[model samples]
Target: MNVAFTSRTLSLSRPQLFRGIRKVQSSFATCSVLSANRAVVYTSNGDPSQVLSALTFSNLPPPPPNTVNVRFLLSPINPADINVIEGVYPAKPNPNASLSSSGKGSQDEPVFVAGNEGLAEVTNVGDGVTHLQPNDWVIMTRQQAGTWSTGMNVKPQDILKVPRSLNDVEAATITVNPPTAYNMLHDFVQLNEGDWVIQNGANGAVGQVVIQIAAAKGLKTINLIRNRNDIASLTEYLSNLGATHVVTYDELSDKSFRQRVKEWTGGKNIRLGLNCVSGKPTTLMTRLLGQNAHLVSYGAMSKEPLSLPTSLFIFKNLTCHGFWQSRWYDSKSSGEREKLVETLVGLMRAGKLKEPSHEILTIQGSEGDEEASQKIRHAIATLAKGQHGKKILLKMEETF
Candidate 1:
């Protein structure tokens, strides 16, 4: 609560906002001890859909130069994490390699941590590390290898200096959704101001951020939500976030709906489309695009294969693309990344960017410890539920 925001930029890839007043507080903490140590361990190499076990803390490796030992405050179990545990995703981290680098051998093959985003604090900083000190909070640069653990030794490169302005809960929600949204918008296609973008699964984590970021950049969004349960209210909520239109899967088929889309844009060709639900939604979205537009598919929520019409492909010359945010951010320069992080944190703190709505799974006392891990797995299995909000989160928070 004592953290302060300085009148400076903290920073991402979407449309780089210029001329806007932005500032960040140096949110760093130093020198704290963790007592009630524990971690959510994956018992078998299977569905994080069921549950994750609570385990005792063991030995951790010494921090090398520019590396630090972190005590995790919170972590989110994203849909991506579930896919990794279920052996469906390809971006699995080398938890074994992370351990081996820590001078620990893996005849046991170090327990694989399943998340791609987290907020942690340094209890100790190794030699030659001046930018970070004890207690300074940082988000994993690239999931930080094994973040589900209560403690970890990670390189500075994989940890971004979190704006001391934000909470672990807010920072925990970040790292993935914001960047994915930013990248998908800025990369693949060049969207001009006032251009319209359409996306299925527009109510999920990445999709929600896409709405906010597009709004911030003066772009219009036609968001597609599943037709179920209070979707009208959900539509209104996203409208508050600057979505130009909120339509259901059923609307995509109506020729009248396409006419309304043109009306909203005033016939401004839709330049880009984002697809997470494949099959029918994917095909319908292509039909609605203008010539040479790009469709970027990040996930297949409907679990259906994407199909493109041959006419739209050759005649319209539309481009199809894929976005893997983890891979792209991993390849960017640190300076470029620092800019992105600073921008995102500044927006979040200023309340310009809405934080991903999360259900906090506390890791404290007896009750929290008993159910925290299970709650994490459950959130992932049903991330798309809970109305229109993204499943932002806090995993464990036991204090000294």
Candidate 2:
């Protein structure tokens, strides 16, 4: 282990540095992995072949400075993660380390881990790392790659340290869905007490969090979900999270749905419409908003293109924006991230926040575990099956 004594006043001795070095080494149960060499690659885009065995691809060692060796404590597979492996997702590549040698850094390399986000703990810290000690919990500071494996050696700047109080699940889920909901609610619209917000995919990871957050902040929510026979059950469940009204897409398509929302909200201005679904759903949502409201699109799960009237943009003065939580969170310091995590954790501890509903699946594959991948596909196929939960995780491990 290398040591940097920033100031003469510093107190780490030789023995302590030696201990830190030992602590920084990654020890995984899988001995077949030689992390110092090539990483496992997903050579092509397709089915399970797309997430095929981490075949070898040659690469140099970890890039220099401001980097760290990270051991994956856990990587949870969410829907977007499955889309990435299928090679259909817009976002691309997950590299554990990028070639920062030329200053563009290893992060630029195309081949990397496949997860958009996951939780990790530090194993080694290169020069200039002070805030993080070995074994400290962290979430990715950037997006794409390097999160699906057992461990990775990456830059310190790409990993955001979590508050000691945050649980692994919350930490791993930090980078994308949760923060997207957070920023959309707080950043785009200037919401006020008693204001109302409407959103699609209400039972989604982001949507569920929005329900609770909006309620916590004294704002009401009108949630939208796809048609399910148990729609009534789903409604009651979301209402428990503070949603004011829960309606189906068919219900939403009704000419009176907007009137119902306006009536339910006591005609209080609905300032924000969160869209993860495009096409007609988004078009109808745009009309539902109060004048000058913001319509934020974060995903196009419907796979259908967006179509809307120009009159809304011209006359209603609506502002349309796109958001990516990964990009926004990457700009903050480790310190700021820890604090945001602290607030979220505090909510969790106080019963204000709940885990995303999930069905844990053990990964079992011919060469490795395939259960995680299978379960992921299942989750995507039947997303609206459940009334109030999102998949907890799709984890890859050596043994069941």
Candidate 3:
């Protein structure tokens, strides 16, 4: 076989190229064209740097019956997503034969795409589809749907259309952290207007959402965060988010802080406590709650066992429970999920809920796959280092 390779930069933009192709297709005698559907996939469970690579297919088949073809708009680099890629999370991706490459895979092995949540645009839909159409924005309704790609073919039942008014960052991140906050607040305890809720890790993604959502509901928050060099600015930021009181772990440790909290609450009972950081700080926070209070644990960033006084459990009758959003989705019906989406989106549209702060990492298509692959690798690297306190989002496509 004789092969020739040549490179040229076409001045035609994507829209212009599509128009030119449409015009030439009716006149040309013979033509061969293929669409490049590129994705990041891995074959084994390990570090993403060693396991992940860019895979491109020359052509994609049309959506089958009851399915839709979607192009991903933006996906987030969440810590849980990285854990899934590393094979340590409770949920794992199911491998598919569609990812098999001619030169990259063994005949018996399958591949998995990375990412759990994202926003996608419907480019095409098959027969019998009624809910979504071309240019409609949608988000994954289930976990482990593999969203880190330029495009995918998905089932209509697996996605829900989002409000068009939402910006890219807000829509991209809605499925995970925001829902977690919403569910945790409602599922564990019943809160009323002017009721007080105290939480640690108030600077985190879920924490931020909890603060905003609680405030919108006319509830008060006592936010606990770590002491940093810029504690003053951090306090101001959380206060602006509608926290009734902002205190550092150092302040939480002070023996005299209980009186201060008592004065801040003006004799009202703190009915609920949210603990994501389970350490001495949370141990101390439990002491501030009123009788019959509920303490819900979602995450443990400190990696330390929660130390609680035995008397508080016995005397105050405090209840401790754990919450996981993934489990909530698994046990709920489709209609329930739809209702939840509507509620959150409605809050967003009414200016009641705000998306957490984030930074964008564009991974646009270019002349070669190498550039796209490198951008993905760099984004994953940035995620590993914690993203400097900003949520990292991957902008997969340039258009739409």
> Best-fitting candidate, measured by lDDT?
3
State the displacement of the C-alpha of residue 189, model 3, in Å, after optimal TM-score superposition: 1.3
Q: Please, what are the lDDT tens digits per residue for candidate 1 over residues 1-400? A: 1233344433532243332222211111122223444566563567665645554443465677777889887787677776777767877666443333332223454656556688888888999888999989898877436677677788888788786679767787778889889889998888788788989898887888899889888899999888987888898988998888899988888878888888888988888999888998889888889989999988888889999989988888899998887777868888888888888887787776787776665655343444665666566556635332545454565433
TM-score of each: 0.82, 0.75, 0.88
C-alpha RMSD in Å of predicted model 1 compared with the true structure: 13.5
lDDT of 3 by residue, 264-370 (tens): 88988898999999988899999999989999998888889998999988999999998888899999999999899999998888887887788887765442456
After superposing candidate 2, which stretches have Cα over 4 Å from the reference?
A: 1-40, 48-51, 54-66, 94-111, 125-128, 330-339, 363-389, 397-400
lDDT of 2 by residue, 361-382 (tens): 4443223223344454454456
* Runs off by more than 4 Å, candidate 1: 1-36, 49-51, 59-66, 96-109, 365-392, 398-400
lDDT of each: 0.73, 0.68, 0.83
Query: What clash count does candidate 1 reach?
Result: 13
The best candidate in terms of TM-score? 3
